[model samples]
Target: MLNIALAQLNYTVGDFSANTTAIISHMRRAAAASADIAVFSELAICGYYPGDLLEDSSFLARCDAALDEIIRTSAELPELVTVVGTARRNNGPGKPLHNSLLAIRNGQIIAEYYKQLLPTYGIFDEYRHFEPGPQTACTLSVREHRVGFMICEDGWNQPGLDYKVNPFDALKQATPELVISINASPSDIGKRKKRHSTISKACQETQLPILFVNQTGGQDQLVFDGASFAVTPDQGVVFEASQFEEDFQCIGFDAGAFMKDGLPLLASALVDLPVEEFTRRQILLGLRDYARRCGFSKVVVGSSGGIDSALTLALAAQALGAENVIAITMPSVWSSEGSVSDSVDLCKNLGIRLHTHPVADLVKQFSTGFEHSFDTPLRGLPLENLQARIRGTILMEYSNSFGALLLTTGNKSEISVGYCTLYGDTNGGLGLIGDLYKTEVYALSRHINQQAGRELIPEPIISKPPSAELAPDQKDTDSLPPYEVQDEILKWHLEGDRMPPAEAKAARNHVQGLQTSEEGRQLVARILAMVARNEYKRRQAPPLIRVRSRAFGSGRQMPLAAKY
Candidate 1:
């Protein structure tokens, strides 16, 4: 029987001290548990996806020192085999470094394998730094059991996929009893389900039981959900770890079946989290980690009493304690009485402090200065944008005075169509809901209330129509289509086939129907043009917590100078 320990940890980029300490602690724990093998996620020594940091000679030197320390520590636990991921220098290679996995026992490196598949797609640019390993399978013998190893993207290239070579096919030829795949997979909507389906398919094809280990925690725009698991050819996923948090588990492999304690384990399906709940957890973790890592305990938000700001404030309050969140109501002459009152109510419900900072006088001052200098009345779009800019400036001032991060409130719909003013509503350190559609912003707000069992977001705020309150009777619909219609068009245009199956089908059907009529066709063309033209604005916006398949920041790249 082979007892394997799975260590699912959260590693911060460039923090070598903390990453090495965590790995060694987990290694000691695995030894105390009397396990045959202890496995950690990819790049546990230096953290995953260090980006351009890989180019620094000092950073590579630090990585080497950390690996050496881990190797020396393994001597104390000679009976336990430790598997870890780190970067290694490639003397003869295309790139200067190789993404490598090392198996250590008794202070010696027994087996070392370089990752063959370096993904260069969305949110991944592995090919930029690390040279791909030659197409070969790496296996090691442990206590009469043969175990194969593969990195994150290697196991992903199952049959009929995009990659030229299938790493799993090479592994099957070697005929190991089980496979151990280390991953740094980032989380998104429906991604956990896709992982299960893909890994299970690989087990069936290779007729090999597999142990998949992944890292947990937020890394800027990417959040990794550590839902590690063990899958058998006959039972699929039998033993699974936790999601959205750190977890560790030890299971037995005996007679070709997984065992917990001593008995055969029953296969259980991964329960799918509700869409709103998944989004809530993802954003909360994202905000918490982003703020903590950036060295801020508090956050400030511009609460316009609109759905977007209301939701952003509520989430910020939840993520960084209500006491750490401050809401500023920057109302102008165009702002409604309900705007201020609703913000007050929302803050009261959330137990957050609210400050009223009127911007009417400030807007008047700006208009006077502009008219005097430019000899033109500050009217129409400029005036409307002036209000937003004033509010954004006030929020930034609060953030500066309080040493707190400013949170931007624009949602995906407005962000996609260039509806937001540059340097106006976009002034913040981070965006809380930039990936969410206007429709999703409302749905998640309601879900928060339902989960709290009270009106945490204020019922009036939820019931009110969304508006920037920058002009008289300014509804979002005056500029763009209703959120329900616009969001569908965005899903079809922005994400396309990358969306989940149900959403992709729905978007395709919606766009196909829209193309049936001339007016509908014109509207579709206009939205597409708006999205294309807004690349410059989005390029300048702060990075948001990515909850969908294709968010505006890192996932979707477009040329600002080009027209389609």
Candidate 2:
């Protein structure tokens, strides 16, 4: 019988000591459970997305030292074999590195399997730092079974894809009875279902039981929702792990069969929660990990009583606990009583501390200083932006005084159109929901209230028309296309990169006869133009946690001066 343990835990980039400590704790647990082998996720030692840190020799040396220490410690546990991911320097001339999964047995490095395919698209730029391994598979003798190893991107390909060298093709030589895939795959809606289906098909074809282990928690803008599992050769799941959490589970297999001894496999159908539940869980995980990894216990957010700020407060409260989350409502002369009441009630419902700081007096004080210099009154974008900047200043002051991290709340729709004020609404240390579209924001809000069985967000906050309230009665529709219409165009133009002709036809169809005028086409064209022009603003924005296939970070690169 082969007892295997999946170690799904959080890791921080470049923090070798902390990562090693996590690995050691899991190893001890697996040893106590008497598991024959324990598998950890990709880059479990160095943390995934190390980015430019891989170029530092000292950093690499520290990682190597950590690995040496881990190997030395593992030697004491003779009953357990460990397979975990780390960065390894190539022996060849010139500095070539590889993302490797090393097998340690009896306190010595027994074998290593390098990643053959380094992902280059989207959030992954592995090819920039690591050289691809030779097309081959490594098999280890563990618990009287031949066990094969594959990394995150290795198991994602079909057998004969041209762009990648499939690990399955390499597995022909080893013909192992069992396979273990270590991954640091990021979370997206419905991604787990697709991943499970792929793993099951691979196991069925190879007739080998497969154990898939993934990392949990967030790293910068990426969140790894661990839903690790093991599947039998017959496509039946043997064991399933939890999502958005750190967990360790052990499963026993005998001769390519899951050993179920009277006890049923601890498994359930994959979660298919409402989009709100998914978003809430994602944001909570993102916030919690950001704080834990960055060494911050408390968070501060500027509550504008808008949907964006309200949702941000909800997520922060869920993640850092009500006691740890602090909300500041900075209202100006334009701010309405309803806005203040709604924000206060929302905070009360969530049990968070609310601080009200009226900015009307401060605005007047600042305006008096500039009154002499400017002949005309500041009534355009400058006036609106000053209000946002004042609120930002107040939030940052609290953050600096208390050593708390400020979470920014701006959705993708507004971000794409450059609707946000730089150094104002975008002044936070991290952008929590920057990847979510505006429509998605409302959807998630509705989901949150539904889950609570009562209104957590005030009724006016939901039913009332969406507005920024930056100026007198400023509604979102006054400046841009409706969110439903805009989001469709964005998905097609930004994601699909469709041509103007195609995009125009799509926009027309989406808006039906409402936006068919030539003037409307010009407006749509202008919106797309603004998105293309504001790439620089997004480039400077705080790292946004990704929950989609395409995000506005390392993945979406656009030339600053290029016309396209």
501-563 per-residue lDDT for model 2 (tens digits): 454467446645435788767767887898999987897787888766678887688888888
lDDT of every model, 2 decimals: 0.91, 0.83
- Taking all chains together, each candidate's TM-score versus the true structure is 0.99, 0.93
Compose the digit string of candidate 1's lDDT tens values, residues 107-214. 999999999999988988999999999889999999999999999889887774779888888898999998999999999998988888899898998898988999
Lowest lDDT 10-mer window, candidate 2?
Answer: 495-504
Using lDDT as the measure, the top candidate is 1
Clashing pairs in 2: 75-107
Cα lDDT, model 2, residue 290: 85
